[model samples]
Target: MAGPTLRTYKAGSIIYFIEDKGSDVFVLQKGRIILISNSLDSASEIKEDVQKGEFFGVKSALGAYPREETAQVLADSVVLVFTPVMFEAFCTKNPRLVLQMLKVFSGQLRKVHRKVREVLGETGQQENSVELLRTAESFYKMNLKDHANYAFKTFLKNYSTSNFATRGQSMLDMISRGQPYPVEMDSLETIIEKIRLGEMDVSQNAESTNFGDMQMNDVGSMEPPPLDDFSQPEDMHIPDMDDTGLSNDDGSGMMDIPDMDLPDMDIPDMDLPDYTPSMKKPPQMNVPQPSASKPALEGITQFYYDGVNEFSKQNWDVAIKRFEAALSINKFENDAEASFLEKSLFELGRTYMRKGDLTNGIGKLSDFVKKYPRNPNLKKAMAYIAEGYEKKGDKQRAMALYNKVVSMPPRDKESNYAKTQLDRLMK
Candidate 1:
């Protein structure tokens, strides 16, 4: 079945002059080939490099062309010869591959054009334009999400420098003042602008406040502007105070109006519900008002533990249900979010895992990993995850994870136990 072509070349030898037979084609099986072009001396220049398992010369094989380049061997080379017949037969058998190749070529052409434009545009004077080009190039090469993350981080740095400290101060000030007092968004904006423009700086006592504390507040207490009122504060005029704390010395403006400077006038007391900033509201037994419940997750969890013990030990199903009920109560509690109560998620996840319900166990464990990536029990949760996988009959995956455990240095006594268990499984 062999054809009449046998070609061999020593290292650093010219296999064939591409110009010698324009219609000849090559299929490389062993060795490296460099295609050189446009140099008076063939050995002096290499335009394209090819290696084993590569096929070239298709363009020259058809009578419509001359060899655009010379092919040489950079190392000892062997190639299978393909006359025009073999190539035509391949194209006939797989028309879908032809279409796929054409699509790939079209995509490459577009990519090249885009790169050319980007390189040209990168020469522009604007930094953002240059940044954008670089971002686009990076996105093209490494994918968009990583570049998006970089861009987001850049935005975050500028944002934190200008806003984080001031906003934190504003929120703490609101908390100190009690009640969700009306904050002029424009005023906050102006403060940030002044800071960015160097008219002001972050106060020397800028203490960091956890954002979790802020979100813990009941949204109902924060009475956002009435739904249909789209008015911006920029449309309203507030008097500018001078060194004397007076509006205008001319005495002809609202400054002349008596009682206008009263603090009560600025902050009115209305029948609108008393919206305090505390995470929890006190229990009301004799007094009757609609009070919000603000139990910490810890209390709810403890209550569940107590309830499980107090409930009939004879009715295991009821005890299990009681435990689940406790979890539900803990799930709704928000007061402890800002402090030590934050460990609730880990507790809840561990409880679910102990319940031996794979769905809830996996769900809680996954969420714990997301919310607390650096938690001490993360490895333990991962071990539970492997158990869950095993429970689901994914033995291959379980083995892969067991291998990881065997390789890892134990983090602590618990992890040492896990590693020991993994070794026994292997045995």
Candidate 2:
């Protein structure tokens, strides 16, 4: 190949090997490639078969680290390549794409952290008490009560003489009591802290750097694994419909996400008294409920009211549907945004974020920012984007947005949070 241009390859051709200097990322125009992991002990094992429309060689291309896996053509293939400079420009325009990459990095970090903790737990009995304690605590916080209880008990049995033994016993008692604990949202603050302290494999701007030193899985990462699977940033295509073939345009498709039911906070090992049935019967009272026929799920006023109600109750899916319905009305006949559109839009975006669809959520919130620049929640939206970028490891972008909010007038909650982030990042 002469440049960042189309390169054709025959079947069974080696694209590049692990540790090879790979400055360009390839997009498969046609045909297939197999990413093989040729470890010293094993024969070249097929790691993944990449197909069209997928992105590959990304880690090495942006990482500036040597290639971590080998890409071998499985068929006669035509590829389009982009150099590092081109890729960086693409990432800047579509930050969401960069966010997706960061998610994969975070997932890898989580896996590595777990593996380290496991290794520590296995190496020594007393030396790894802190690891054991953390293991128990993590399980408890994650709602894995059985695992927590078992780990705590095991820690207590083995490290009875250790300082943490008392705390382990206390945790066991708390587990036995089965009280509801405050459910904390998943966060990368720990990872952020490690990065800040120079203990993590991250750069000042993870979106642009910091993949070389880290151990990232070729096949198990969050993004698609093929060189052909990635479309251009300009395309910015959404994935196909869910299993039900339902489109995501209307919020009804949110049925894809299951209800977020908190696990019952009851002791699993409880053994109690048996009750004898009493002869006396208790009085029953009749309760009234709405009629079977309800409001036709249409119109701005109806849907808007319903949306607000659902949003307040934290029924994100329902709220999304109502808000979408309200906004979907024709603009000329009824001012599409007259009544509750602004608030509905904000909540719709928030709902998406709550359900862990950051790409869509950020997109929607960004739209709100553009359309309603003077809305009271403008700073709040900025705050969300800042936190979103922070969570996705785009610290530089996050810092810029947080700084923007801090400079604005009024010491509101969102501004205060932004100030806090600014302080933390500067330190």
Candidate 3:
């Protein structure tokens, strides 16, 4: 049998499309390719970027089913294409490759089964044990404590006898105790050695004191000598005293000094002055007071109402400006303002669509979908996004969104319109 054929494709090349008939598996040798497909129920578009040394089209080719995706070359690329018989022969010689394919197939199957159950509103199906453990581990690694805690608890509950049960339980306990992942710490011996070295460094850098020829390690330890240890100087004289200690000239026990006369000077007195205060008061001045502040959401409501008025009048540009102004207001202090903000965003997207700006329209609606997931206008916004993508010639994405709308519960006007579009697009 001939080996696989190697082919090169330039950027913007389409290798295949959905529903195409082929039994050839491809392996990306270089550059990039994007596989665009929808979910099992066609409710969401799945874009898989094929990396180097990865296989694509294996399941569909091997199962002899129509191609489930459209493979478009994203860059100048080289690919190896193998027929089903050649691939089987190649896998027979490479058992590891077969094992890898089996793992991939099993994971894909599990995801499909999960999506099916979700679409059928069946909540009783048990989640895969390995996937649950992996999810918990991923969340833990990302430091999402709350999500990790929930995932770990669910895993432990469902897989009590699993090999990873002990690890899951330990992680749960750590999370409960609010302990982060363990970090490597220095040993006791290392810490003690560091302390000892630090003390030695301090001692080496300390200043010493000198007393005569002796050096003291610590200056604070020395004391001063007593004051009575010195004798009187030899040149100093002392007077001898009799029993009464009297001087002969005074005939008294005390010495007498001559009195000195002081001169007197003429002095003049001056008059002092005093004053009394008046009982007049100062004039009062007028000061302006600040006006009362407006409510936090004051301008937002007006802008939203103005935008709605313009939108109803089919003035797309003016409506967009008003909606943008409403969203530009920084303060959304309360739930009422927040609701208005959501409405403003949704209307802005609708205005863009009306103006024939599909890119901006799709962008704003997509933002609304993410930012206001629980908003009452979510389904309507999604339908508008689908309509935008349809107008932009992206039928795959449009169909996917339409399918999602149809799958959502409570068949309202939007869902009904989506179902009609989906049926038309399918036909």
Candidate 4:
């Protein structure tokens, strides 16, 4: 109600599909929908059914491109949408809502990042989806028609008995109505098989934890569907005229990205070499500035776009490459560039950390610190460096950095962060 205007789509209409970009949080007011994705060949279609009173499209377009899947109207549907601008305004108007939204963003982004890492083989698999699915069914007390399907049975045995069943079930519940399957069964099968193999490997190595106490007890059910208070059909209509200056309910038509919030970023400070008088001229500059490198810049921009695609698809390796390439081309401009760099470095470090190569992670963190000594994120970089050192069995060095972080002049977030790290180190 506080966000954007509402829109309605007839049944069978395609809302959006894989690779589309925009931020319009769709809230289903009526009718059913299907979330789907097709492989490159357009042969494989994975479908997930979304029910009424649910939200989709909100999570996928979080300032990223190439959405993971497509959404089709399964029936005459009514959806209330929120654009990023509208949502930001809502957050500004409501601090409580901001807190809740921040929590969701933090947890969801982290989860998606981890999933991308796992799927890209950048991180070792912890639990396979077969077990995840089985755990979901068991957590819901589902009785399968057949136990002969090894896939389904193993899913049950591992998921139902493991300590992570609750979390697994929650994921299923999110996708249960949203229909998150890909267009290709083969792709789905590939993912499934990977999970299965990963699970088997896990089983061979470690004892499964008991999940008897992992059940969620007091979670609140989702709120009822939002109701519109319009009194008449004509009330929704407006006088037709040229230059109406009206935007869609999603407000994407009015989209204009403001300067990025660099203060909130976790990045390093790098000294950008100023362009000399000669370098500023195309004829004299050696760095290939087609239009002073417009073509190369475009190529790098495309790479960043593709990286967003990969990031959305949970392909962390590919996404990281794209981001790295974009950084190489030209560091982003304004605060957006800073945010991108910070996020990229943090994620890159995280990817290495997840792979159990803390030494490499520490090196990356060190690079950030050396480059951006005055950056606010320098504090985070140092903290991560300390963590990396500790992970690499260099506790003495870790403690020294931790002490330095806490001893910084400003008694603000960085100082607090340093304090937290020092306390952790001491502990």
lDDT (10s digit) by residue, model 1, range 1-427: 3342657878888756756665556778888889877754344665888756556775666654777677878888888776677666666777986577568668977776766767776333324422443343344234354454454345434444432433333333333343132221223233333344443344421211111112212333233222211111111111111111122222222111111011111111111011111111111112211112425444443434333232212233443443444444534433332222223344344344444455565565556555544443444555655565556555555555545444444334335545665665667
> How do the candidates rank by lDDT, highest first?
3, 2, 4, 1
Expressed as tens digits, the lDDT of each residue in 1-427 for candidate 3 is 9999999999999999999989999999998899999976679999999989998998789889999999999999999999999999999999998998899889988888887878887542533775676578568657899999999999988888664354466556667676553211111122223234441122321211001111122233223211110100000001111111122222221111111111222112110000000000101112111112324355665666566446544567877887788787767666555566776787787677666766777678778777765554566667777766666566877888878777765555457778888998899
lDDT of 4 by residue, 36-130 (tens): 97754578988887767555776665666667778899899888777877766765887986677678789977887887777786523544654
Give each model a TM-score: 0.25, 0.31, 0.31, 0.30
Q: List runs of model 2 lying over 4 Å from the truth.
A: 1-298, 331-339
- CA shift of 373, model 3, Å: 0.9
Ranking by TM-score: 3, 2, 4, 1
| Model 3 TM-score relative to the real fold | 0.31
After TM-score superposition, the amount by which residue 346's alpha carbon in candidate 3 deviates from its true location, in angstroms, is 0.2
Task: List residue ranges in candidate 4 displaced over 4 A.
Answer: 1-314, 331-343, 412-414
- How far residue 92's Cα lies from its native spot in candidate 4, in Å, is 52
Better candidate by TM-score, 1 or 2? 2
- State the lDDT at 146 in candidate 3: 93
lDDT computed for candidate 2: 0.54
Instruction: Kindly list the per-residue Cα lDDT of model 2 for residues 1-427, writing each as its tens digit.
Output: 2345788999999989977997988878899998877654466554888779567899877768888788999899998887888777777887998899799879987777776756776423324765676688678767799999999898888887654454456556667777322121111222233354553334322311111111122222322111211100000001110111122123222122111222222212111011000010001112112222333233444555455445434566776776677666544233332534665576566556555555556667667766665554566666666666656566777788778777665554457678887899878
